[model samples]
Target chain A: MNPKPDKKIPALYGGIIMGLISAIPFVNIINCLCCTGILLGGFLAVMFYKNNFTPGTPPFTAGDCLAVGALAGIVGAVVDTVLSLMFLAIFGDVTQQYILDLIRNMDIQVPEEFYELFEEAMRQEMAGFAIIMNFFFALILDVLFGLLGGLIGYSVFKPKGQQPLQPSPPPFMPQAS
Target chain B: MLLRFFSPTFLIDTVVMKASFPYIVLVCLAFIWCIAPVLPPMLAWHVSPANPLSSQLYTWFSHICHQVDSRSLHLFGMKLSVCARCSGIYVGFFLGVVLSPFLSRRVSLSAIKWWALALLPMLIDIALDVLGIHSSTIVTRVATGVVFGVNAAFILTPLIEESLEKFIPMNWGQRKQGVFYESQTR
Candidate 1:
């Protein structure tokens, strides 16, 4: 158990920084990299929390992991949402049109009977979903990834002496004051 | 009283853990297999104006990726619901979880600092894509996924075990209660 009262602030700061790092353009794309950064961020939070806890505090618990994970998810989600909005605004329509044209060009082998339906299908599918569509998907992914990250972080960075039934209560318990 | 209530859960968890390792891998494989077929329609459904079902379906995967179509996989007749990287992630993750219990001592968490090296494939893939040097083929994407999945599984199981040990805070008496219940049921 750590005796530091100020450690919580640093943990929060770590979470915030991690969130921002995940939100950055391009770098944010690395989230797909096994969610390495996000997981690292969650681990950072546990590291901070561990340092802050008073001596004899129970080593990091699943509950702590979950909390940290949730924060990382929220952070990643916000950044992802913003990026989605931008991606939607640009290149989306062009992409849809490009696919439609490509399919049309490939129509030589395509069934003459099914050609019209196929074209309609491509057009409708690409132009269909709204900005909010992208928003929600980004949000859920970040949360799940964050939760996983938090768990990993807890495992790697958690303090020693945290076994179940060990019951190492904090050193400075308020003595019925 | 608390011990009695929890005894069943522990017994069940232990039994399932011991019995289900191989089955879990199959479950993971089934999940991976399904993704390839379901993805295209789900993606097209989101972008198709004619399909009123698209919006709700789109909402389902919204938190994960832009689902912008190009950044996603094209399976059956359309793009997958999630982005390419995500598809790899879940497929990999499930596989990793399934494979964890069977690993030899060489692959155990404590011995393999090389697990950290697992992050490199993904890093290189994304970096190459960023530089316009290359696009990750489906096979490469999946390969990276498998690597990440293995690493994640290795890291995850131990952490989960540790977390359970801490959060549940069981005593020997508690553990014994579970053991006794299992014996009695048998």
Candidate 2:
């Protein structure tokens, strides 16, 4: 019997998809809808893994889906952090400027102290420690959301009333004269 | 029909309650998750505005939410940690989970189809707003978010319960067989 296909390649593909959606500016907005991007990644990973199954192999289980999703999430977190840092280097905190523009456009009253605090927080956010913290937090969320996505994938893709393959009987031999 | 729907006999099933322990636990966790974002503003109001805890909460939520103050709901003169749409989604999810047991368990639509239907309105609203066609108000944002959230809960809860049922028994059987064989060998 053939062994089940390795999960790493599919997981990597899923992670790349997650990273691109999460790290890209403006595109990352989709994630605000309950981490939809991360979920999609995990779901796609399960789909890819399911495609690898052949007849006679043990059917993929929910536990397998969970593990693949979590691995994808870890990879995605790394990719997202790297891409975000690269964007930050190029764009110089576009998010902060966007927020300032929004506040200005809204004409909301803000105390000067709030501005000071916001700037202080922004400064700290750019620091190495903050970036690492952000990565860890993202990792936690990605794994959780990914697991959910895996469950959804399993429900959608599970074969109806699948049973184990029975070994075929050996060919009957004719009696010799 | 409405009265029957609200009746205690219809609403509460002891067997379902016993069977749905995981679902109940999930609902509680979701409640906590939804409430976390709201508490920062309240804490800032009741306690010092400069409270580190509130700031921490805001910072934590910022990862997941754009949190544009203009687009967020304000309470106690402070913006929520998440946007109005996110707030609506979270609240609606909690409501959906609470109501799931009483609602019909049978699902006619597939998961992807259900998700697409749920997301359609939000996508249209966002597209229009982005194109400078129509600006989305807080009401529109919240309404769309709620639709998506409610649909998501209805789809996910049953699937999760089913998966748990499938996974738990296999493990239980293995453990039981292993114990039996070990005792027989002894």
Candidate 3:
């Protein structure tokens, strides 16, 4: 695009939205919709980009979409990690209790060792912050889904049939014997 | 006309099969493989309650899903690999893949926005129930999830097509014609 829209602000806004939606309890179910909520953040970023950048200048390319999406993804990862950890800190034990209850209902015979392992793992995850797991999940899911959302946004936002410079074929000439 | 969409070639090759052939192949296979866990989990549960496959499915999906029994659909007298809403989303994604070809490959945000719209009722149902606004049902969850998932397919199929174009400039014919020539990734 000929004009510049400060890209970072919109992307950060979008990423934050994605992260909060993905991290929140109950609301996080929206990710069940094939990460629709997360991708929407990326889509929103592109929408902001389009609105700010003059339309039809260079046209928003897929590359632009990916960049915006990626920025949103990175921001989303940070947000998701912090929020998930915080939420886990507050409700982690309760959530685990619910899981235990469900296991009893299911009547599955889990060895005592597994529960011990799970508890130990959880404690470690909480204590160590498990930034690696959170960051990895966020990075993969955010970038991929965000890129998709950007593409959808592109389809919706991009002006249609506006290829202003189609090369014309040579004029037809009659052949002489 | 629609039959062509279901033909073996269509299933095998996909929309614009010849364009960005490699990316399409890779993405489709990867997605299929990723979502393939649902069935195995059920089978494992049937075979042995604590079967490895079933346990593994639970362990992995637990990160992504709530996996509460009440919220999940039961098959073979056992809980599914994931919650009901989640199951609906996955199944709906399959349907979306089926329907994508019939839909316009239009690059319209409106086309993509429907997925969010689809989720409104589900979100409302949950909020209402949680807040004691009203009670929500499992059906509500699954139905809303399906709507979101199906719409997602509409967005995704096109994205895959677009991504391929962006990544690989050459069409199938061009690649085939120049097969023996010095090739470059770009």
Name the top lDDT candidate.
Answer: 2
TM-score of each: 0.56, 0.76, 0.65
- lDDT by residue for model 2 (A1-177), tens: 778789898888888888888888878888976788999999998899899888867788766787788888988899999998888888866777687677767867988797788778767867999899989888988888878877677767766564211111211222443
Q: Alpha carbon lDDT of residue A102, candidate 3?
A: 75
Docking class of 3: incorrect
Q: Tens-digit lDDT track for model 1 on A1-177?
A: 443344345445555655566555455555544455666666676666666666565555766776767675666566545654455466444444565578778746766667677556545533436435544555565566666667666656655454322111111212332
* Per-residue lDDT of candidate 3, residues B1-186 (tens digit): 567656776554444434345344544654673465466556665587767777756655655566778888877766766788878777776676555555434334454356567567678877998999687678987887777667766666555555556676566534654763555443
CAPRI grade, predicted model 1: incorrect
Candidates ranked by lDDT, best first? 2, 3, 1
In Å, residue A78's CA in model 3 sits off its true spot by 2.4
Output per-candidate TM-scores for chain A, rounded to 2 decimals.
0.54, 0.84, 0.75
Instruction: Look at candidate 3 and give me any clashing residue pairs.
Output: A155-B107, A155-B108, A156-B107, A156-B108, A156-B109
Candidate 3 ranges beyond 4 A from true positions: A1-6, A20-37, A83-122, A160-177, B1-23, B26-34, B39-57, B74-78, B103-144, B170-186
Candidate 2 versus truth, CA RMSD in Å, comes to 11.1
lDDT of 1 by residue, B20-78 (tens): 33333334454764464364476565566456455555446543356767666765556
Residue A111, model 1: lDDT of 68
| Stretches > 4 Å off in candidate 2 | A1-3, A86-123, A160-177, B1-17, B131-134, B165-186
Worst 10 residues of 3 chain A by lDDT: A164-173
